[model samples]
Target: MPKVVLLFTGKRKSGKDYVVSKLKEMLKPEDCSIIRLSAPLKKQYSIEHNLDYDRLLDSSPYKEAHRLQMIQWGERKRESDPGYFCRLATEEEDKPVWLVSDCRRLSDVEYFKSHCSTGPAHPSCVLVRVSASDEVRRSRGWGWVGGVDDGPSECALDEVSCDYHVINNGIDEQLDMKLKELKNFIEYNNNG
Candidate 1:
């Protein structure tokens, strides 16, 4: 178990990765590392579809072209095992602080709450909701897809409880303040 598990959820292109990237720069390497719940999904999907996993992980046309299908495939996988990707993402992490960068559904949050938070290490698990305007997301390359934008994967945690609510609009004053608040949470929770 980690000293803190910072679980983050946000809509597509809401700057979830960007916020965590900023956190990575703020925190020392030995103190924190990012874990993406989508990494395992993309790895498996690439194998099944004979696609390059590297390309799938990149921000290229190939990834955008298959984003919807990959989302559907991941949904099916989650239906069978809600914690599959969540487990894969964290099982190997030994850092004292884990920034889980892509928590989409409520189950993702629940998984950490049930497993990591209760271990002998007594990890501090907390939800963080990252938000940005739809216009900002569109500008960041997230065009609306009828089924996915309407689906459970995107909407499951829209109203869920969170310890921090951050508005990431390109690292403005508001974002800096919110990030400091989050750092306070981590600084309080970190083991050393």
Candidate 2:
């Protein structure tokens, strides 16, 4: 049982969590474990800052001002010590497919690729990018502060590329279709 890690990022309320939840339902919890890298950091930050964890994590101010640095530091920490994300992935011990949601840095992807590339325990990973308008995201109380400039900046585009791009413009049906297509692709390749 190899793994399928779904890497994604977008403004808060852009359906990253909702979409991942839907995928989990479709795939079943036994077959997959959806994990986020920033989740722990978000918890710690919230505790230190006295902010709601959900709101702080979804806030645009957090993303715009600190996500990059936090992600970079996380990557360095992981490199120096390999068990950071790996431990979380293996904690459940069910060998369920690991859906690594909220994978933001190139180093994060690189770590997974290096560790899960071989053996029966190997992971079949698929990178997915979720996108949506800031207005839509903000209205949902996602805390998008950057306004219209929230789309991936040029640096982001160059830094991270996805195997699949899903524009989450508020159509549940369409999102289902995209996730289905990704599932089909993963199944096809893994079988082959």
Candidate 3:
């Protein structure tokens, strides 16, 4: 079991991936693993739709074209089982530290918190929110999509409390400070 599970949530282009990557760099790579909840969703979506799964995983036009449909499909799956994707993402995980790169809903947070709270090797589950201005996200290729940006997956955690919040608007100093704090928290938990 992991010593810590960082459950991250953010808008589409809010730099969740970037921040997670930075965190990974700050930690020992062999002791940590990055988990994307979207991986299983995209894999299933690809098989069902006969699309290339690899393409769907990339930040490319192919992914953009299918993003809405994929989101809808994932929502349906989540409705039937809130922890389906969460379970899939961590089913084979054995790392000491897990950086869950994308957590979109309150259900996702609950799933991790509940599961990580009980075992003998239970880890400290930390909820982290990453945010960027509309202008910054737009500059990073985030355009407002009706059913996507305005959907529950994007807005569900808007009012949710988080243990840590990262404002990633491309300011180096500010981002570094937030990330350093998060790193220190993780280290403290791991050592405690």
What lDDT does each candidate get?
A: 0.86, 0.62, 0.90
Model 1 lDDT tens row, 33-97: 89998899999999999999999887777987898899899989989999999988877889988
Per-residue accuracy of model 3 over 10-66 as CA lDDT, tens digit each: 899999999999988999777789999999999999999999999999889899999
Name model 2 segments beyond 4 Å from true: 43-86, 118-123, 142-159, 188-192
TM-scores of all predicted structures: 0.92, 0.67, 0.95
User: Which pairs of residues collide in model 1?
Assistant: none
Error of 1 at 78 (Å): 1.4
List where candidate 1 sits over 4 angstroms from the true fold. Answer: 118-123
RMSD per model, one decimal: 2.2, 5.0, 2.1
| lDDT of model 1 at position 99 | 93
How many pairs of residues collide in each model? 0, 1, 0
Predict model 3's lDDT versus the native.
0.90
